[model samples]
Target: MARNGRSERGATIIDVARRAGVSAMTVSRVINGRSSVRPETRAAVERAIEALAYTPNTAARSLVRSAELRIGIIYSNPSAAFMSEFLTGIYEEASSTGARLVLLKGEGGRPPAQAALKRFRKSALSGVILAPPLGETRSVLSAVRSWELPVAAIGAYDVDGVACVRIDDRSAAFEMTRHLLDLGHRKIGFVLGNPDQTASAERMAGFYAAIREVGGVEVKVAQGDFSYASGLVAGEQLLGGDERPTAIFASNDDMAAAIVSVAHRRHLDVPSELTVAGFDDTSAAVTLWPPLTTVHQPLRRLAAEALAAVTAAASAGSTVATCRAKILDHSIVKRESLAAPLGGADARSDPDA
Candidate 1:
C-alpha cells in the first residue's frame, strides 16, 4: 500500500524506481544483485524497495528475461543416486525462480567444459554448474573461465575462478574413521574414491591421519572408482586376503553397499564378522541390508546453494570469482552396519598402549 493512503494491491519495480529517482533499468539491476550498480544508487534502490515492499513478479520477470536466464549443468559423475538428488535440488530452485536448467555432458568422455561451451555458444546459457570429476578437471575449468557466464562447482575442492558449495570431505571422512577406531576396530581396510576427483585424495588423507593418531593399527588399502562394481573388486581383494580386517570403510555409499553385498556372498555376518562404513548418506545408505553407518553429506542442499550462486551471477552480470564459497557441515551417522569387533577378534593389541 502507498504511504499516501490510497488502496494499493502491490508495489511494482516502476514504483520503486519512482521512489528511488532512478531509471527502471537501474532498479532492475539493483534488484538482480548486479555488481555494477553504484553504492549510493544501490542504497537508494534498496531503501525504496523496502519502503514500497516491492517483490519482483516471477511470471513477469520470466517473461521479460527468459532467454537470458537459461542454466546449464555439466557432469561426468558415475553415481546415479547422487546425480538424482543433485538434479532435484537444481530443478526445485530453478522452477521457483522461473529459470530453466539444461543438462549437458561431454561427448566421448571429452572435457565437460568443451560440451558446455558448445551449448553456451548455441543457446547462450547464463551460467553452468559443474559436478565432480568434471568440476575438478583443469582443462574444463580453464575453458569455462574463458566464457562470460558464471560457474559453480559442487564439492569441497575449489577451482581458480568458480564458486563452490560443499561439505568438508576430509574432515567428514576423519570423523567416520575416528568413529570406527573408537569402536575397537584396529584392522581397518580403506577403499578410496575416484582418483580423478581431488576428493579421493582428501578422504584418503583423513583416513591416514586417523590411523597415524592411533599408533600401531594395521591398515589395508584398496582403490575404487566410486562405483558399485569397483567396490566389488576392491572388496574381493581386501576380504579374500589371508588376514581380513575387522572393519571396512568405503569412500561412498554405493561402494560401501557393495562391501555389504560381498560380505553376504561370503556368508559373513555384518557387524558380527565385519563392520562396514561409507561416506555420503545417500538413499543407498539407508536401503542397504543393514543400513549404512556413513558420513551424512547434504547433497541436495549443496546443489541448491550452488545453483543459487550460479543464478545470482547470471542475473547480476557478475563472474563466479566474485562470489565466495558456501561451505556446509557434515556429521557421522551411525547405523547397524558399524559395531565393536566380535569377541575381541581382530581387535587392536593393548587397549591403551
Candidate 2:
C-alpha cells in the first residue's frame, strides 16, 4: 500500500502523522507514550503507524529520554562568538535530552587542553566533546583515549577512533574565495586563523587553490588567531601596505569584523573602496555595520551532532571503534559587506584610464 505519497518500505513520522490526520508532534507524543495525548488521538496514530509500517528512528529518539547522560565539553577557543554559538547549540540539545553538561575551560599556560583534561579526569563524565583546537591536538586526543571515554571531536580532521562532526572547511573557503573573485576582486587579502588548528590550514589551502584556478590574482596573507585582537594586527599589516587589496577574506567572522574596523579607521569606504568577507557566519558577522558576507558554517548543528555522537557511544558503553567523520554542509552567505571593486572589470584592464 502507498504510504502518504511515499514508498511503504521506509515510512517516516511525517507519513504516520499524515495517515492519522494529526500533527507530527501529536504523532510523536503518541509514539513516545506521552500521557498528554488524547486516547482517541493515540489510537489513531498507532493505527496509522501499523498501516504505514512506519519505523521511527528509535536510536535517535530513545537515547535522549531513555537515560541521563553526563557529558563533558572541553574548550579553549579564542573566538567568543564561536564559543557562544557552539555552547548555545550544546545547551539546546542537552536541555531537550535531559543530559547534564559539564563545561571545562582549558586554562593555564601548560597546554590549556591538558589542564581541562586534568579536571575532566576528576569528574564523572560518561563522554567528552573536544572543541578545536583541542580536538586537533594529538596530546589531548591521546589523553582522552587513555581515559577510555567515548569521545567526539568538533572541527578535527583525520584522527582515529573518535566521532567527529565538522563542515568541509576547505570547500567552504574555496566557495568564499570564488565569491570575492566573481565580484571582480583581483587583489585579495586573506587573514589566517590560529596556526594550531587543522581548519586554519584547510581554509588556507582552499584560498590558494581558488587563487591558482584564476590566474593573475594578487594575494596578500596575514596571520590571525581567530580573535579580534589578532584580526586588528593582521588588518593593520594588510591595510598598512602601500598597495591595498580591493577585497579581504578573513578565516572567521571575528577577524573579518576586525578588518572592517581597520578599514574604517583608515577612512576607506567599505564595498565602494574595499570589500570584506568572513567565514563562520557567526554572530559577529551580523552584529557589525554592513552585515558581513561570509561562509555559513553550521556551528550550532556541528555542536548538536557532536553531542549526539558522544552521548550515543556513552550510552552504549563503548567508544567509537573507528573514525566516524560527519561532514556537514556549508553555504556562501551574501551580505552588504561585499561588492564589485571600484571602477569594476574595466579597472583591471585600464592602466591609466
TM-score of each: 0.80, 0.80
The per-model lDDT (C-alpha) reads: 0.80, 0.82
Off by over 4 Å in 2: 1-67, 108-116, 349-353
Q: Write model 2 residue lDDT over 1-353, tens digit each, in one string.
A: 45754664477765676688864545655766768778888999999999988877768567645657788888888888999999999999778657799987766322455665777777777788888888877787788888888788889987787777799999999989987887678899999998988999999999998888776788999999898999999999999989999999999999999999999999998878999999988999999888999999999988987886676555434555225578899999999999999988765532321
lDDT of 1 by residue, 1-353 (tens): 34553235477655676699864546766877868689999999999989988877777667547555777888776776777888888888777667788787666445555655665556667788888777788777777777767888898475667777788888888888988888888889999998887889999989998888887788999999988889999999899988899999999998999999999999999988899999888988988789999999888888877776776656545555234557788988999998888866346664762
Best by lDDT: 2
* Candidate 1 Cα lDDT to native: 0.80
What are the runs in model 1 whose C-alpha is more than 4 Å off? 1-68, 107-120, 321-323, 344-346
- Indicate the residue-level lDDT of 129 in model 1: 86
